[model samples]
Target chain A: MDNNTFHHALKIREDLCIGCSHCMNVCPTEAIRVKNGKSVLIAEKCIDCGECFRVCPVSAIIIDHDDFNRIFDYKYRVALIPSVFTGQFPDEISEKQIHSVMMELGFTHIYEVENGVEILVDAINKYAEQNPVQRPLISSFCPAVIRLIQVKFPSLVDNIIRVKPPLDISAGFIIREFAGSGIPAEEVGIFYVTPCAAKIAAIKDPVGESSSSISGVINMDFLFSKVLRQVKQKKSDTCAIPTSGELTARATCWSLTNGEASQLSGRCLAIDEIHNVIEFLEKIENEELNDIDYLELRACDESCAGGVLTTSNRFLTADRLRNRATNRDKAPVQKHPEGFRDISSEKQFLEDNISIDPIKPRSILMLDENMAEAMKKMDRVNRIMMLLPMVDCGICGAPSCQALAQDIVQNNAKIHQCIFIQKILEQKGEMSLEEGVSVMQDIWGFSKTNKYRDLKGI
Target chain B: MMHFEFPIEGGNFLKAGSASSQLKKILKQLNVDPRIIKRVVVAAYEAEVNVVAHAYRGIIMIDIDTSRICIQLVDEGPGIPDIGRAMQMGFSTASPEVREMGFGAGMGLPNIKSNSDELSITSEVGKGTTVKITNYLEQ
Candidate 1:
């Protein structure tokens, strides 16, 4: 793969795949196609939204993450967890208990990912104010949504606020804090417990920015089980685990829907789910929507709470986080322990480094780089569409009829791949039965095509 | 060149911008510059909405080639009595219902003019109106 290509954290287990088109049918970007008894992912078109992972019936789709033992390599193992991780637990599990359990599980320190939100809120508003021309500045909070814009809605790339998200901001702060304490950066490892594959991709192949501050990624579900198992086994103990600063009510719910939009001072709108975001962005691209200052878009329906790696129900996790925020607002602030350090002290450092380089648009819609060639290809695609059936049966392994047409134009697929065209060719003696079976075998594997005996009853 | 046509039902705010949306998809597939696509779509959408807000019915005709895209929206309804005044910003004769739906901002013509490379309007009072917008592919 080229270095410039997007790094996807979602992977398909070829050994376990049944060539089921479920993932292909539900993919928001149509990045998956079935071939040779397995679903193949088009890396360039995939945004790592994990929609395919959600729809995969056989659990063939898996998210790649850093090994849990990798954290032990460094002297200081810091687990940067989002609020949703704790939201997976019942209310009886206190935040301190969660932190203590994580500390027992080989982490030297525990930090809330939303701690960066305090610095980020001000930077986002300032960015929106500074760039008045880019109306309805889209949030860079969701990595999946950022990739969605890069691939699908390329024109709106400029409208995305050029700022690091809370994950990176918190990582930057923690790295600085470690440095201030005379701890070498190499000795400190900050691993983000991510709730989605998109975050893992973002950390591995950062957009706009040259590199990510976080060292490694640990999937939320993996860590949630580890922490929960320990919490259940051990009784509450007063173990003084070094922890980061507390999160405000606003910051606690910052990863939830409308969290950032509610803080920004303007006519802002919060939209979640990949399809809903795409629909709204289409209108925004067409200039149908106007006079909006900010837009908060998340790929998952309930924001981070609905991330693919989440173990709890999306609504319940969201409700729990909201309740936590409400309780935090009403409760009195408690004194910090001896090892607790306020992240606000590094606010100036974070704000100074908040702005990232401009994000470039990598449009996947075009057939070719050259305009003249693309126009020719599009004309050919349209002509091909006239011949193919419009039913979008997916027997051709493509998501829709239009997709197969484009694939044919691009030479990635054959015209006869369409079952409708195959039947016509067979009827006209233009193609042999053996040739048709071979094509089917090539797309669906020989087992599926040679299963005439299994279909006797049906 | 590729030619396409879509019929726009007037006074139907629900279906407004459908034509422009289709045109935008075609331009995207043709590898048009993002800036140019934005201009064409904005102008096309404005014209489409104008027909929906003021006309009884309209048909949008689009002609595209490697060099430029030309769009024509012809509608049959109350035509512009004074084209020059209508071209001015904040000048609208839209009904109260149209304004209520946020369609009659009086900036439609001006917006289309700014976004399109060439914009021409021909109308006969109480008969019909025709809007032609052309956008170049290259800067």
Candidate 2:
């Protein structure tokens, strides 16, 4: 609930962690550190990109979500599903069957999150037209990318489009519909079945906005398994649950890579994956890139299909979604069929509330808040950098020698934490051998340090 | 105050702007305003590319303090005969080869002038050029 620090849904369980340093090595922001045989996350530096979750070998990383029974608390339970969720299943499974299975599992209504995309496409173009100087308007679709910009590319914060993403717009539309039908807001609960940890964190602690209308978050893998189980056990398909209106081809593929970029008219480019995004952003920040009008950046490869909580292979999911979109484009549109709700009727209302407040930069790069003090600390860091071996061994509980130097100047770590420094001090008769072993024990945990067996035993 | 220098190799388009990138990192660590950092980096990048496109070899020296950042780019090459003409936009004496690689677009000096608070240039017609750029931290 503390908005000052980022709310990370990715939690590392110490009981299962072995301090293998895989997560530390893969983190794009260098937010992870090995301490006491466990990987610790620096919350302020994490953008919830799920890179650590993907690289964790011991399965110690877990994404937290709301309890399934929480949906029963409200009179009306509406599952806000994304297209990627449906793409997780085999091609034989129809979208109607998935909705029916969700209904059988106790959901009163099913709505596609991309229903808002019908309205967002126009909004994005309008936003770009109005802000002519803020070239290369960055999409706000990916929460991790938004947080990354705030933390790493603070100077480019103004380039992010202020319009709410499709998820929020869809949630707003559905909530308004329930209210319009005389259902009290408390009785209607909108639960978003999320594809990644970033979405959960965004719903729990949103940026540029105070709170989200989403009542709860359900991991995609959990719901995918539940629906798959029901589909397998079902004996008859005659439940006759009213299906939600089919999404347009554009809406169906809205969360995929190049989904938004292909729709926009300009010199737009879509870049997927966190590291690639960082690399491209550096060029943009340096003014090395020009004539770019828009950018669609996602934190995950293949976009939402490659979400950490997804069960199916990313390529297969994306392929299925692409096939589905192609089929939808070829099919004729049905006009107000049985139980089909037209979200387009609420487009005006969604457009009115599409804009969000300006996002402020929360840079974690500075050594100190005061420029004068930070300059002094930087000088000390440079001095320490010269003394420490730049081997980046990670034995010092920091990711690199530079990181340790910064930590030392910030008083979060000591200079002796570096093994190279410890040996130099010991040879000069400044510290004893017992002191050196204790330092290793403190960083790598007691058990790992105590078992200094000979390599010849094997 | 802190001082640092980075060497630049002329005609090495691949390594150009490395000094500006390093300077950008240092400014961010110093808690400089994001707008100010952008301007300082843009100016530095332009000066860096100028050295790569025109000079044979160069070095960038930077001095940072609480008040401002001053960057001096010195290059050994055929210096400009007319500093006034070089400062004008779209006035480049670069070869067609340099223009093909998207460098030596005469806007380099003009762009640097617009992005920095203060700018100066001194050149020995047959020897080299030294460009000094300063950006205020508080502004």
- Pull out the clashing pairs in model 1: none
Per-residue lDDT for B42-85 in model 1, tens only? 99999999999999999999999888899999999999999999
Model-by-model DockQ, in order = 0.80, 0.92
Give the per-residue Cα lDDT of candidate 2 at A190: 92
- Pairs that clash in candidate 2: none
lDDT of 2 by residue, B1-139 (tens): 8999999999999999899999999988888999999999999999999999999999999999899899999999999999999999999988899899888779999999999999999999879999999998775
- Candidate 2, superposed: residue stretches over 4 Å from native: A1-3, A235-242, A333-340, A453-458
Question: For every candidate structure, what is the RMSD over all alpha carbons to the true structure, in angstroms?
Answer: 1.9, 2.1
lDDT of 2 by residue, A148-211 (tens): 9999999999999999999999899888888888889999999999999999999999987889
Model 1 spans > 4 angstroms off:
A1-4, A236-242, A333-340, A453-458
lDDT of each: 0.90, 0.90
